[model samples]
Target: MEKQVEAIVEWLRQQLKQSGAKGFVVGVSGGIDSAVVANLIKRAAPENSLGVLLPIYTKPEHMTDSQKVIEKCGIDSLTLDLTESHNVMYSYIQDQLKGKNEFNESTDQLAGANLRARLRMSALYTVATNYNYLVVGTDNAAEWYTGYFTKYGDGGVDILPIVDFTKSEVRELAKYLDVPEEVITKAPSADLWEDQTDEKEMGTTYDRIDAYLGGEEIPEKDKDIIELLHKRSAHKRDPLPQYKRKS
Candidate 1:
């Protein structure tokens, strides 16, 4: 774990130097992915890293967890409440679709979630531009493989430090980095909505998925879930093939 962390840190430092980044701006979602990314930044560039907590009607626990992570990592941070921005967007979208009959509650909610993610990304980018810092992504391999991230939302970033680690590997690295036990033990969630859990929404657990990915025998029921997720999210893993012209 130490070796992996060191390797990633070195890579990050090189990227920062080559890109001439004065510092880093990250969205710490109070989840393991963001926590690990922030920790790595602290390890690599302690003096120049800044963590941002962008909460949009999120639960108090989410803010609490983010505070714990910031405290544990001892990095500079600021909180930006996106409630107003989201509300303005919600109103605009509602008015735009009022007479079209094209939007429903579910669609609105999904759009709202995506908007929140994108707003956070926009804020981070603005900060980066003003401060000459690079925006670090918190996405991991499992989420990327499953298309669990929002396109141009959480997926938009200047750098991704842990894109290759599975969700389980992230937890292991979190422990090795001495992240708060509460964060390490809590259930994984995107916190996009109330009472939502990642595994429950995906209909599979990371342990089983990781085991299957590692070539271990998986139960029939679990295998079905894994296969379904993989199939459905295949588009996220690759771009559409372009047609070639005759030479």
Candidate 2:
């Protein structure tokens, strides 16, 4: 883990040099993945690293943990509460869609959640632009493989440092990086809605995803669910389709 940490830090420096970017900026979500990223960026460029906490109707505890991560990583940080932005945008969209026969409450729920994610992404990019820093992402291997991220939302990032690490591995990295104990132990969530958790939303556990990635035997039911999720989310992992003119 120590070597991995050193290597990742070096890689981040290389990426920064190559992109001509000043440093790294990441959204601190009070989760293990974001906490790890906050630390990595600070190590990569201590002076230039920034951690932005964007809370859109998020729980108070999450904000507290996010602040803890920023302090623990010792990165220059700022808090941008996006709750009003999200509320304004979502409310307008809902009003425009009202009286439309095609509106579905279930779909609207997801759209609302995704809007929050995209709003956060926009805020991060805006801040990154101000400081000429790259916007780092917090998705882990399990989330990447399962496409459990919000497309063009949390998925909209300049770099994904831990995309190769499994969820369990992320926790281990968090430990090595000295992330807050509460943040490390807390149930992983995108905070899309109240009581929402990653595992619960995916209908599968990260343990099973990690085991499957390792080629270890898992329950047949779990294997099926995992495969189905991968299949359904295949588009999320692919390049956008574009029309090609015939040669």
Best by lDDT: 2
- The reply for model 1, stretches above 4 Å from the true place, is 240-247
| Residue 240 miss distance in model 2 (angstroms) | 1.2
Which stretches of candidate 2 lie above 4 Å from their native place?
none
CA RMSD of each candidate after superposition: 1.9, 0.9
lDDT of 1 by residue, 33-121 (tens): 89999999988889999999999989999899999999999999989899999899888889888869776876877888888889999
Question: What's the TM for model 1?
Answer: 0.92
Candidate 2 to native Cα RMSD, angstroms: 0.9
How does candidate 2 score on lDDT? 0.93
Give the range of the ten consecutive residues with the poorest summed lDDT in model 2: 95-104
